[model samples]
Target: MLIKWSKDLEIGVPFVDADHKVLINLLNQVDDCITEQEETTVLGSVLEALVSYTEYHFTREEKLMELAGYPSIDEHKNVHQKLFHKVRAIYHSFAADRESVQVDDVRSFLQSWLTSHILVEDVKYRSTCIDKSEAAKQAGMVPFINTNGTHVPFNEWGFLRVLLVDDNPNFGKLVSTILKAVGISNIEVTQTPSEGLALMSRRPADVVLCDWVMDEMSGTQFAAKMGEMEIPSKIVMLTGYSIDTLQTKVSSPNISAYLEKPINAHNLLDTITRTAFNG
Candidate 1:
């Protein structure tokens, strides 16, 4: 099935929309490969590409959400972590038991997951983020080009710095890259939650993007530690899981935003831009 991009999905963030276009194209390629009855070798190559791209895309999104100070980031990051593990486990099983691997299995999984994620969870955040961004702009926190082509400098837009925290080294790098791409220069990353917390104590960032689950400390635990330490940065939890499960557990004074996994760069950027400018 062709997943057509529409205006409703535009969250006023440019880079993220571009990434989503790539993601949909890749998913379509997998579908096409399945339809062509491609050999296992070809199918495996496609699957590998899918895995690699998905990992990168998800990391980009989580980092953006973290930068935006999304309140539900932890839940979203959890979902991404779980899905990554699930996909990786399946890939490993296929490699170990080649005879049991089927093209249909891979196609079905990717199609279902991608479709649901984009249409449902992702769309939900667009309006909220847009409103927040516009509000920030109006409040003179973020500068925007007026209709006459004049630029307005907002004091709040450039004052904030951020840190991206995740256990995956690749993810941390990817996040840093995306941040720089979006005009955020003062960005730091750490693979350890402890280091992220330590950074917070020494020099509190304006915002933080943290993964939901990590080997040493979960994002929730890290956020709790920040609160205990009286760290003042706005915490945006990153997760790949359902926010419903974490809503009750996460209270105010720590988390300012929550963003789901596979976060769009546009929404993430807008969120961060707004949060920085608004704050």
Candidate 2:
């Protein structure tokens, strides 16, 4: 089913409303691609477009919120960041194995995710911004200018030393590529749990992206041990396993976030940023 934009989704912001229209159209295109059983590349391309456009829309929307001095801006920004990460994870997993994931599933997921945010979360900003505008009009207050860049550049993540723990070299390389794309250059890829431990012992990372199933030990065990050792590094689980099983294993507080594979650039960076900086 295709998602249709309705007036109920509008937040009384012209630019934001326009961006939402484009996002809805892009999601509909993805639904069409799934219906047509388009090639994997085609589907992946559409998902990439959606991620890129979402980032753009979010940057602009956040700027508008900042200008209006919205009281819940931090909470709203967190929601936006999490939604993008969730969407990217779903698309990346679908792109990896299109046969297992149906078009209807993707369509339903996107529709619910997008519509819920618009109606529930975004609606909170509507009355606040409208009231601010009216008050400014009455008091003759000038509009705030966007002097600082609204979009946060990826260079901010460069200082983070990330340790990637996975048995598969290819998966490690893929994650390295994604990290580099987000301007994270200080990365140490270790194929075994012992190697990862050694690297951490020598120089602790700001963030550690670890796989669930490993040769010597599982990612869950490593995270539990790390917790016992009380390492300061934020640990993010990277796995294709069942989330239910993953949840049962990660009772320890060391695991900061669990992301599904094959991971996309947007989600990996978002998870890292949320784990390392937001905390």
Worst 10 residues of 1 by lDDT: 140-149
Q: Give the Cα error of residue 11 in candidate 2, in Å.
A: 42
1-279: candidate 1 lDDT, tens digit per residue? 546667765656555565566566656644654555323333444455556556766766665665556788788788788878877776566547655667677667776776677667666555545445433333322222222322224333345589988775544544554455434678889989998988889999988987787899888889889989999888777766666765666655668777655454444556665555455
Worst 10 residues of 2 by lDDT: 139-148
lDDT of 2: 0.71
TM-score of 2: 0.49
lDDT to native, each model: 0.63, 0.71
- What is candidate 1's CA lDDT for residue 32? 55
- Deviating ranges (above 4 Å) for candidate 2: 1-152
Clashes of each: 29, 0
> How much is 91 displaced in model 1, in angstroms?
19
In terms of lDDT, model 1 sits at 0.63
